[model samples]
Target: MVKMFLDFVGDKFSASNPIPVPDNDPLDDCSAISHGTHVAGIIAANAIGISQPGFIPDVPFLGVAPEATLGAC
Candidate 1:
């Protein structure tokens, strides 16, 4: 499901790839992808995960939106 969502975003949003810097570190690429991917993962992970809100059952995980839904301001 997460892969589907990422693919959908990749397809629908036709944006240029980040500029190709010479001798770029793989960590840089991971970091760049992580920035957005982490946000998306947090939002949809639980719903797609096995236990939902009860997954943690102890520790409090911060959600993508602890206040309101994410939408255009």
Candidate 2:
């Protein structure tokens, strides 16, 4: 059941490839793509088998809901 959910969400919103932004301009030289990628990582970091320590000691840094689906506008 968990595997199915992961597969479905992964297929729908995998961030392995770069997603295009509507506007190519950045505000004050700040890249919107960079910000978006950071936010996305916070929302869905699938840390199922990672052994490295995350931002917090001993605890793996994972998203609020690793299996949750995500979409960018």
Point to the candidate with the largest lDDT.
2
CA deviation > 4 Å runs, candidate 1 = 1-33, 47-55, 58-73
- Report the lDDT tens digits of candidate 1 across residue range 1-73: 1111112122222346544333322222234345666675576434422345546655545566544343210
Q: Which residue runs does candidate 2 get wrong by more than 4 Å?
A: 1-33, 52-59
Q: After superposition, how far is residue 39 of candidate 2 from its true place, in Å?
A: 0.6
lDDT of 2 by residue, 1-73 (tens): 1221112222223366445333332222335568876887888887655666444445556798777766543
> Which candidate tops TM-score?
2
RMSD list, candidates in order: 10.8, 12.1
Error of 2 at 24 (Å): 16
Model 1 per-residue lDDT at 6: 19
